[model samples]
Target: MDDTGLISRLGDVVGEANVLVAADAVAGYLVDWRGRYRGTALCVVRPATAAAVSAVVRLCAQAGVAMVPQGGNTSLCGAATPAAEGRSVVISLARLNRVRAIDAANNTITVEAGCLLQRVQEAAAAAGRLFPLSLAAEGSCQIGGNLSTNAGGVQVLRYGTARELTLGLEVVMPDGELWDGLRALRKDNTGYDLKQLFIGAEGTLGIITAAVLRLFPWPRAKATAWLAIAAPETALRALIALQDRFGPALTACELVSGVALGLVRKHIPGPHPTLVDSPWHLLVELSAGGDEASLREELASFLASMIDDRRVADAVLAQSGEQARRLWTLRESIGEAQRIEGPSIKHDVSLPISRLPEFIERADRALVEAFPGIRMVTFGHIGDGNLHYNQSRPTAGDQTLFLAAQPQVNRVVHDLVDELGGSISAEHGIGQLKRAELLRYRTPLEIGMMRAVKEALDPRGLMNPGKVL
Candidate 1:
């Protein structure tokens, strides 16, 4: 059987309209949102249900064709994009967007793979619950992609990562077997946790069709503050103070660099807030069961204490929900601001909270010395130690030249991260971007163990080929 035969067979399983091969129709499926990865696909298949997905996978697997499971195509590392070979069939889960069920009593929601993250959040909110996995692309990113990458967003400090929130998953195995593991039980230690393997596997083992996600009680009140700190050390002190004072109510603690803020202010339109000029800033928030006024007063009191200690140089407290959103806009727009600024090497790295200050100082010193005039745009979820440590080309340097120096730049930053006990890729999975770097950082034995698991689950190596080991 050839590509035509497979396409026809897939059409038979799904409708012919769902099997898209036109240049315009499949264009978006071939490339990543960052435009860093571009690939060719024989066709893009849209399966509307788990059973249909199983049929499509069975046909493709029997035809010896590779399958790339894609959702939302919002991957920072090109995890959801097909390879340049163009021989694979991109199994898009977009048509599977649906809310399976919501069990408010059990604090769980079962959602299909293609359900937009924002949609899931809205559904939970409508049911008087909170689904806290939030990211800049939540409006466009899908639940399957979130689970596949084990996404960690701004609220990870309080709610946890996608893996921790996911209670069960429905996966279509590489060989076209359907594994219906969508059990919403909070505790079932029967044996090996199978759902976990597929959660962060980046679709190598199987295609996630649906998931049962954990939910929480909605916060009755919220207090948001934007604190201007002198440096990362000052930011750390503020984090400790906020955690000590508010405990779990301290939901988010984001660190943004002055340089990063400048880009957002310059490129992104704003009624942006006015604050004292500082080298670094911390976007802090506290949400708990109380009235808004009292929460704000408590947060204001804590800010006052910080001001006396000089840990916080200046602070701006949001008096309303609208103001809080504007503050969040500043922090969330860093990536897009960097995008509009220009192309450069990007690192989604994480370090121990205590080691972050040292890592930043050492890495900054080393990178500047080596790259001479490189621009750093850095910010991240301070509570979780994940930093979106990105770089831009020198003010007048050619983009091509700066991009070519990526490997050398990576060595400098990634080497230091390893030295300080950090991760090369944090929230972002080890997709095509970090495939080579994974071997460099991980031991051969560790890689072997991963390979063994992949082999056992997907012996033919057809599932999301050429990604994550």
Candidate 2:
């Protein structure tokens, strides 16, 4: 399509005010949140409604101009960012924010894709329920992006990922047809089950406009604890013990390496409330709709036994709700702390929970041997076997040279993960950054099947092209 002509057409479809073509105006949408990718877009279009999204998509498809669907623009893997060539038009779903319905009895809330993650949580809370997909980016990340990546957060141990929290979706297919599968049905044995296609497609197959998300009962009783563990394996053992005692009430169990905590203390401004000597820490939360005193007492008794057995080195249970949040702040600050430390090679990989400790030990040893003085920050939901295994700059090497070896470093970490029946990209989807790695790791047969599905839904390949499949 002619550049000027296409821009004019898009402006006509969504109005001039919604169509952004100026370089300064479109710059923010071009680059990714991590500043790792920069793509040029002929323009960026903002549509306020599902119908507008369908129309703009249809217009772009007919013009043969590639389009990118972006929400919140918080992707660490360049999923929401455009390519360096900037040949496509970035469509921002931020203006499509709307809450369609909320059924407390059915335990579902229908919302537009542009609504921020925190807004959804607040809406659920207002309805006397909870949307348990809590994450550090909850204040800024959007729901559409959450579903597109099948996001896993601190609460995934109990409530599951974005995939589990979702019931239905309203997507604009690549061909511009609206798929109205936004039903609140608990069980519908229909053929094909099409809604699953777009959930984690990263906007490759279609653009998610809205979703019907599942909600849970708000917990009345909650207990949070910070434990100093001897090792990762010990943390794993304590996890099993706590699960046996607390059962379903065990909501979150996160592993935090001392190295990561060190970064948090160094880069982030704080009093460093946690002792600097603990080798590893576990942030454990138990939530229920029962008596708070009973839950706290039970957890304290369990921890005392664990300490006696040498599973836990030392521990501190939150004495009040504010203290519990303070404990969680340390866990949540790791990402920001790393950001301040400078660009590093990161891998959000996951393995079988049974293989987690071994995977960590081996991967750390291998990376350290290959890249001496490389600071390895290993921490994540050990209960789920997902580790945000990241490697900081070596104390001696040139920063540019070290970053240039990301692909090789990724191979070392991902190879071990693959050998242990793990995924290279865990909660994060195969966005633009990992698209090539995904192709390298996935079998040809699997890639063929994914391509077939993508072609079946988006034959024109105009919706979020150059992403996942």
Q: Rate the local accuracy (lDDT) of all candidates.
A: 0.93, 0.88
Worst 10-residue lDDT window for candidate 2 reads 268-277
Please provide, for model 1 over 1-469, each residue's C-alpha lDDT reduced to its tens digit, 9 standing for 90 to 100.
8999999989999999999999999999999988999999999999999999999999988988899999999998889888998479999999899999999999999999999999999999999999999999999999999999999999999989999999999999988889999999989999999999998899999999999999999999999999989999988888887888889999999999999999999999988998788899999999998899999998899899889888888899999999999999999998998999887689999999999998899989998998889988989998999998999998998899999999999999999999999999899999999999999999999999999999999999999999998
Q: Residue pairs in steric clash, candidate 2? A: 39-83, 40-86
Taking the tens digit of each residue's C-alpha lDDT, what string does model 2 give over 193-236?
Answer: 78888888899888999999999888999999999987888888
How does candidate 2 fare on TM-score? 0.98
TM-scores, all models, native as reference: 0.99, 0.98
Local error of candidate 1 at 263, Å?
A: 0.4
> Model 1 misses residue 129 by how many Å?
0.2
